[model samples]
Target: MTIRVVLTDDQPLVRAALQMVITDTADIEVVGEAEDGAEAVRLTAELAPDVVVMDLRMPGMDGIEATGLITAGTGATRVVVLTTFDDDDYVYGALHAGASGFLVKDMALDDILAAIRIVAAGDALIAPAVTRRLIKEFTRPVVSPPRWSELDGITAREREVLTLVGRGLSNTEIAGELSISIATAKTYLTRLLAKLNARDRVQLVILAYEAGLVATSQ
Candidate 1:
């Protein structure tokens, strides 16, 4: 299956460069390109790509707000935030806002492509330390919110899967831990991701942390 993609960044050269790299992959296709956040949203709605490569510093909408809007409105489209700044503040805000993946611009093209493929396959995320740095910088000391009764509909096993996900455990690891098959673990993750209003495992991880589902795990 072709993984349709959208590239959103203010700089034309940057967008072109990313396009060249992404288009090199046989399974990935650039469906659309946007110059700013609003255009990103607009193009996203129109093209309904499988993934979005977004820049945080764009004018008009910014990646954080764009990620929130995109995830909330079109849960089918996964977002991968790209930026020059791996600064904790930007990374945390983008993930909290609902990005499916986070990549530093300094990362090699291969690394960025791997991120896109990981999220496109279903649900994937960056390293634990990457997520933790952002979390510590952005997560307020405020008390965690109570789990809504809606979440109670999820099974205890699902909760465990969620915890593992938030802890940055891959489906293979979750399967190994639970003594189950990878397919079963991924199925559980898919159901939990759908139920939690999450775009992917990455967003679920953020939610798990935000709602105190997993502590000292990120």
Candidate 2:
């Protein structure tokens, strides 16, 4: 199935660069382009694209708010945040706002494309270096209380899957670590998402951190 995508970036060059690369791919198509967050939300509602590549800073709405709106308003569309900044606040905000993937602009165009595909395929992804930073940053004290109670409905095995996900392990990796089939690992992940009311794996990762399932020192 072709993965429909909408590019939302303030810079014409950034949007054009991504569209140029996407045009060469067979399974992914750029369905629309938006210069700001409000336009992105509108395009997402109209196109119902599989994924939206969002930039953080824009004239109005902003990517974080746009992401929240898109995810809340539509079940079929997902957002992947692609921005120049890898700041901790941006990462936390984007994931909290329901982005399925978080990528920095400096990453290779090929990798970014791969990320879009991953998100489109119903999985979530974060840049490796960013994942590491995110894990460490979660150890810091936050202004609001951590929602540890969210994990109450999940089983221990589900908690294990969530922990590995928080550590940025893929389903295959989680399977190997627990000596289970990849399919079983995926099942646990799906259960975690449902039981915890998570939007995606990114939200599960945050839940793991908030519940103190992930080791900060690791």
Candidate 3:
């Protein structure tokens, strides 16, 4: 199935580059382009593309707000935040705003395409470099207390899975770490998602951090 995509970036060069690469892919196609967040939202509503590649900063609205609006307003279309800035604020903001994927501009174009595909398939992704920083950032003591209630209904095994996920381990790695099969790892992940009401893996990572399942030294 073809995955329709909308490119939302203020830089024409970035959009053009992405479009050029995406057009070469048989499964993915660029359906629309937006220079700002508002236009992105409008285009998303009109085009109903499978995914939107959003930029963090724009003249109006901004990617975070647009991401929230797109995800909240439509169940079919997902947002992938692609930006030059990997600042902690932008990372947390985009994830909190319902972005299905978070990537930095410095990543290879092919990886970006893969991320779009992953998100279009109803999964979530975050760049490896960004994920490491995200873990470290969350390790710092916060002014507010951790939300332990979020993990109330989850089992101990599910909490283990969430901790591995927060550490950016893949399913295979999680399975290996826990002496389980890959399918079992996936099942635990799925259960965690449902039990925690997480939107995707990214949110699970955030929740794991918020619940203090991930430690600073680890």
Candidate 4:
């Protein structure tokens, strides 16, 4: 199956570079390109790509707001926020705005492609280093009110899964750590998602951090 992609960056060079890399992949296709947030939203509505590679610093709508609109309105198109090291505050907004995942701009092209594929497959990816940094910067003395009801009705084992997830472990890694099958790990995640009313794994991670289920000490 071809994974349709839309590239959005204010810089033409960046958009062109990403388009070149994505178009080279066997299973990915660049269906549209947008140089700003509003254009991204419009193109996403028109093309309905499987994934959108979005730049966070664009003018007008900006990627954070764009991500919110795209995810909220379309429901099917996933947004991958592209950011630099100084964009931690924006990263926090992006997370709450329904981004599927985030990527540092300087990451290898192969990793970026893999992230898109992972998110398109309905999983979230946050590099461990990036996750730690964001948590360190965003963690407040008081977390916002619980997204759901303070983890009520959740089992101890499920809390373990959520911790690993908040720490940015993939399902395969979580299964290995717990000596369980991958399917079982996925089942736990699905249950957590439903119980917490999360839109996806990214939201689960946010909840885990906000609820102090995961620490930012690392």
Candidate 5:
């Protein structure tokens, strides 16, 4: 199946460039384009693309607000924030606003495509630098442990997977940490998503941080 994508940017040149790069791939399609955030949201609601490549500095709605609304309202439409600035401040905002990943605009075409594919697969794309900063930026007052109450339906192993995932481990890494197979790790991840009612791993990561599963310790 082709990966349907929507590109949202104030610049026609940049959006066109992205479209050109993505179209080179056989499995990706530029389903539509949006000039600003409001239009991005409207088109997203209508088209329901698999992925949205969002620019941070749009004129009207801006990437941050658009990301929040898009992720909150859409089903299965993952957003990857793109920008020339890696100022670090924007990182938290984008993720908190519901971006699945952040990519510096200068990234290679292949990396950009990979980021989209990663988000579409329901895995987060935050590198260690971003994850560390995001954790520090967001985890101010530590919250309570993840409750067995809300987590009633989750299995013990799934709980284990969530905790490690919350710790920022990838699937391969998580499997090695738990002495399980990669397939088993993915299964646990799937189960965690279902039980926690999380749309994707990004939300799961947020939940873990909120529930005190991981934090920047003293």
Candidate 6:
């Protein structure tokens, strides 16, 4: 199936570059483009693309607000936030606002394409550098553990999976860590999402951090 995408950025060059890279793929297509958050939102509503490559600092609505609107407004559309290292301050907010993942602005074009496909396939991603920073940044706070009843539906093995996910381990890594098959690891993640009412892997990571399952040791 062809994955439809919408590009949103204040820079025309960035949008053009992204369009070129995406359209080069046989299974991906750039369906629309927007120069700001409000336009992104409007185009998303109209195009209903499978994924949206959203810049974090667009004028008017901005990426965080646009991500929230796009994710909430369309059940099938996911947003991948594009940012520079300077935009790290907004990463947490963007994830909270429902971005499926994020990509550094200067990352390899191949990596950016992979991220889009990963999110389009119902998984989440964060650039490795962003992951390291996210761990360091959120680990500064000491949070209380959530109640057992809150996690009553999750099995111990599933809790283990969540912890790995919180640490930014991919499905294959989680499988290797637990001596399970990748398919089994994915199954555990799906169950975790349904049981926790989490939206995606990013939310699972946030929940694990908030509940002190991971990123608590200093």
For model 5 the TM-score comes to: 0.80
TM-score of 2: 0.88
| Residue 83 displacement in candidate 6 (angstroms) | 0.8
lDDT comparing candidate 3 with the true structure: 0.84
Give each model's whole-structure lDDT.
0.79, 0.83, 0.84, 0.85, 0.79, 0.84
Report the C-alpha displacement of residue 8, candidate 5, in angstroms: 1.2
Q: At residue 113, what lDDT does model 3 achieve? A: 88
Give the number of the best model, judged by TM-score.
3
Assess every candidate by TM-score.
Answer: 0.79, 0.88, 0.91, 0.88, 0.80, 0.87
Q: Write the per-residue lDDT of candidate 1 for residues 36-122, one digit (tens) a residue.
A: 889999988998999999999877888998888898883589898886643556667787788877777888888888888888887
Q: Compared with the true structure, what per-residue lDDT tens digits does model 2 show for residues 13-81? A: 999999999999999999999999999999998889999999988887889999999999936898999
**Model 6, C-alpha of 176: deviation from truth (Å):** 3.6
| lDDT tens readout by residue for model 5, 30-92 | 999999989889989999998888988879788989999999983889899887544455655
lDDT head-to-head 1 vs 6, winner: 6
lDDT (Cα, tens digit) per residue for candidate 3, span 13-38: 99999999988999999999999999
lDDT of 6 at 56: 92
Tens digit of per-residue lDDT, candidate 6, span 125-153: 85445565666664445335564465778
lDDT of 5 at 33: 96
User: Which sequence of candidate numbers ranks them by lDDT, best first?
Assistant: 4, 3, 6, 2, 5, 1
Give stretches of model 2 more than 4 Å off: 127-130, 137-140, 179-181, 215-218
Model 4, span 1-218: residue lDDT tens:
99999999999988887888887899999999998999999999999999999899988989999999999993599999998878867888888899988877998999989999988988787656556666677654435665446688799999999999888787898999999999999999999999888878889888897787776563
User: In candidate 1, residue 64 scores what lDDT?
Assistant: 90
TM-score of 6: 0.87
Instruction: Write the number of the candidate with greater lDDT, choosing between 3 and 5.
Output: 3
